[model samples]
Target: MEHQWVLLFQDAASVREILSHLIYLSFVLKDSPPLFVKLNVAIILEVLRYAQMHQLFPTFSLQTIVFFSLELVRVTTYEEALGQAINLQKSKLFCSRNTLDDLKNLIATTLGVRQVLGTCKYLGLPSMIGHSKHATFKFVKDRIWNKINSWSSRCLSQAGREVLIKSVLQSIPSYVMSIFLLPGSIINEIEKMLNFFWWGHNSANSRGLHWLSWERLSVPKVFGGMGVKGLKAFNMAMVGKHAWKLVSSLESLITRLLKAKYFPRSDYFGASIGHNPSYVWRSIWSAKDVIRRGFQWSIGTGEHIPVWDHPWISNVARILPSTHHHLEWPSITISDLLITPEKQWNMELINTFFDTVTARNIFNTRCFLW
Candidate 1:
């Protein structure tokens, strides 16, 4: 960072924070040009240089130039300026060509008879921190490049996918249990259900309505129809809780619990805390106070809200335009969604809200169906 000196005394946080922010920006702002080319990059470099002048990071640690280089290019150990650095390339995790396969093989082969879990996982088992055989479901579809690269002819087969999914599900509980403080169990359960939802993507790729919003499938064997929620829709629904955690902070007990445990010192419902929040929180704010879309069976405009007695005013929620973006976070109404009457379906999911209004699982445990 050539401009580190300029930003040194100005304002800066930890290196990880800076790196995370850059990566995040690069992700969300993919449509824009490379962030480094922008003036802010030079400015930050100058600031980092200033920090080095003031002994901000240890002289032996990653210098500003190295910091930029690591993220931007392959930093070679041969550089005389690096004194006697480790050969990061050969010794690093990202350097592996078969990252996924290598990780999976490491987990399945090494931890096969371990009894508890496997190795492909991330951070789950207490013994998995450096065990190299952690049975974790790596987010393979995270980056755009990775996602595209993964779809090539060399990608794993359907049978392999099935095995991977099953293994991932099996390891979920163990991994989640390790994160005892967080609601990892619920998150894990959700992930499995998501796999079930997407297991038959091709069969239901085309919907009676919009192809993206999956038509509900009753869980097969138990329910008359095959039970499958659309993965995309389920993801959105799961993400919705985050928005609620933020916009309706006091309204959600789980968010409060997480905040109490993970961030007791941090504000639970502070609106001014973060510039960008996780998908869950952001989705909550987007859904707002509006009745759940899944609850409204159709474009039943003027259908009264039975609970609040607020008249149902249905229209296509203009969800995309800037006019509708505000409608997402701190949800204003169902109308806030960028929708048309045609896209809105008449599938009701809130028929029995009264049954579980205050109690969890009390409404759906027995013979009743919503």
Candidate 2:
């Protein structure tokens, strides 16, 4: 009953073959012969209608579909996949290969795809050159430094400098910070640049003493410090957002990709930092603690929740008293307490297994039953 859409073709002829196979599959699944014939005819008519509405010859549209389909496939071997890309005519490849001369020559002569190196930009974010966190974010520091060097602080008022720092300089690394946990050194460099812009002499070469610490300045308005954004906390919050998305948006493409690559056998809540993970993946994993502190499960059927461990009951201590360690059934779920037909908590069972105070709390706790 499971159906999969495959895109291994570059022309209308391939699409026709696929459609014919689908029609045959439908016929095999349907019991009534007349209905089977009608279903096949309907599918063909719908395909024709789709082609007409899009103003494309049915065969021509196959190339467009093929182009889009490439996004879903992970290209492991560029040379092998190059033939298919060439056949499409509308597609090209930008490759990052190792320094083996034989392999490079083979790719250049046979595949003809454009070769690139570590400097390639993806979605405007530069690729990390190596494992060094500071070097990875050096460009972000350079960018902000250049901007500060270009501006003459002498001509601008204190208020103008503050406005520029908040609006312009702080925003230079906002995009990169969202994905990478920037090094403390890089953050200090950025803060120094901002500090120099705010308190230093107007000349780019002149130095000035900071009247206040960067940490104090980063505090909120209600606090004693200026309300400036701290790079480290902002980076953590941004990465934490991705962790939140992985839990809440299970069907999202990012969630699916991460799940497949990092935690195929387990859920996001139970995922660990596996061996040799990418820097981006490592940064996302680092936010797991933040996500766990804020997460609470609402009681539904509660079949998947552990009674003692899960943070389900609101306004109560998360774990039971250590004195109750002798009690068995550590892995029991809330669903085990429910009466089968009536779907209500078994009071006698609860009383038998728990102390008077514990039993009373369990009986009084509100359950969402979702």
Candidate 3:
């Protein structure tokens, strides 16, 4: 089994090398990885996981294997990693300054890797430095432009154009939008591309007068608009979905990473925007407000839910009204309102603290006590 595992690692390395080459070619060609290549890479990852689980390298810790295996996978997936690895191996480090002879010696050394400067495509998305939103989304814009330029608007009918815009053109940015809070400029550019495509402009460079504003067009068909999704809202909703997962999918890898890094002491909604957060974290954080706006607690043990602060009551303010200026409510849990022995809400206590209207509303509102 150990010998077979060794052979598997060797095979994985060869497969990784081939994948690295294919990834490089795809990057050079400015195209996404083929479906077959992605499937093979997934298989390699599963095999690596299995090998790790079985303690293939008994001499080394699983952490060590995982660290190196991850690097191998990174090199295979991203051309940038492969280039960086080759550069490191060749001692061709890119820095602000180097000694004259050192530079000469470095130049004289045989080039083993493609030295990527500034930004490069990684898994069909631009991997960039800093927060240059426009530059990062330039590839997406170019892709949309190329796709639009390929098709003739004059040939397609209005209905056909709408179908293509909704189904094909809008989907171009969906993957990127899901991860990044797209800049308004990029969103507008995408909308403009879609508009031009839908309206059937005289030529690729020309545009017909927009019949309705994109804001209006983005409304649901039932709401009297074109039923096209608003890009910004869609992006927010996608990020909010991640936030939902962070709360609900507690055992997920992403949830674990986020909890360790951002909200070690607190929950996801209460997490602070800590200093120097990653772009992904910042994007996720931006959608927290949206999540909070729509979120309502489904009472479990009620230990986590605060009666005064939390939005426990349906169609009511999160905080209850204070009786007097000096009257300070303690951090009251939802469990406090319940009769402990029977595990039921204390109706008399509820009526005592709240106003008649508020008390009536609270009684009417359904709550799960478990």
Measured by TM-score, the strongest candidate is 2
**What's model 1's lDDT at 129?**
31
What's the ranking of the predictions by TM-score, best on top? 2, 3, 1
lDDT of 1 by residue, 246-344 (tens): 434554787676565444554332332245444233334344433243322222232221212222323323222122223334334333221334443
Q: What TM-score does structure 3 among the candidates reach?
A: 0.67
> Model 3: which residue pairs collide?
300-370
In model 2, what is the error at residue 318, expressed in angstroms? 5.8
Misplaced by over 4 Å in model 3 are 1-115, 202-204, 315-327
Cα displacement (angstroms), candidate 1, residue 334, comes to 22
Pairs with steric clashes in candidate 2: none
Residue 3 error for model 1, in Å?
Answer: 20
Candidate 1 lowest-lDDT run of ten: 361-370
What value of lDDT does candidate 3 attain over all alpha carbons?
0.67
lDDT score at residue 330, model 3, on the 0-100 scale: 63
Tens-digit per-residue lDDT, 1-370, candidate 2: 2213333233336456655644565466542244334434444444444544655543354443333323222231242445543333322344445334433433343334555554545665756446677776788999988888788888899888888889999998999878888888998888877877888554447767878878888888797866888888888999899989998899999999999999998778788899889888888999887777777777777787767665665555554422263367776887887775676688997788778777777777666752
In order of listing, the candidates' clash counts read 53, 0, 1
TM-score of each: 0.23, 0.68, 0.67
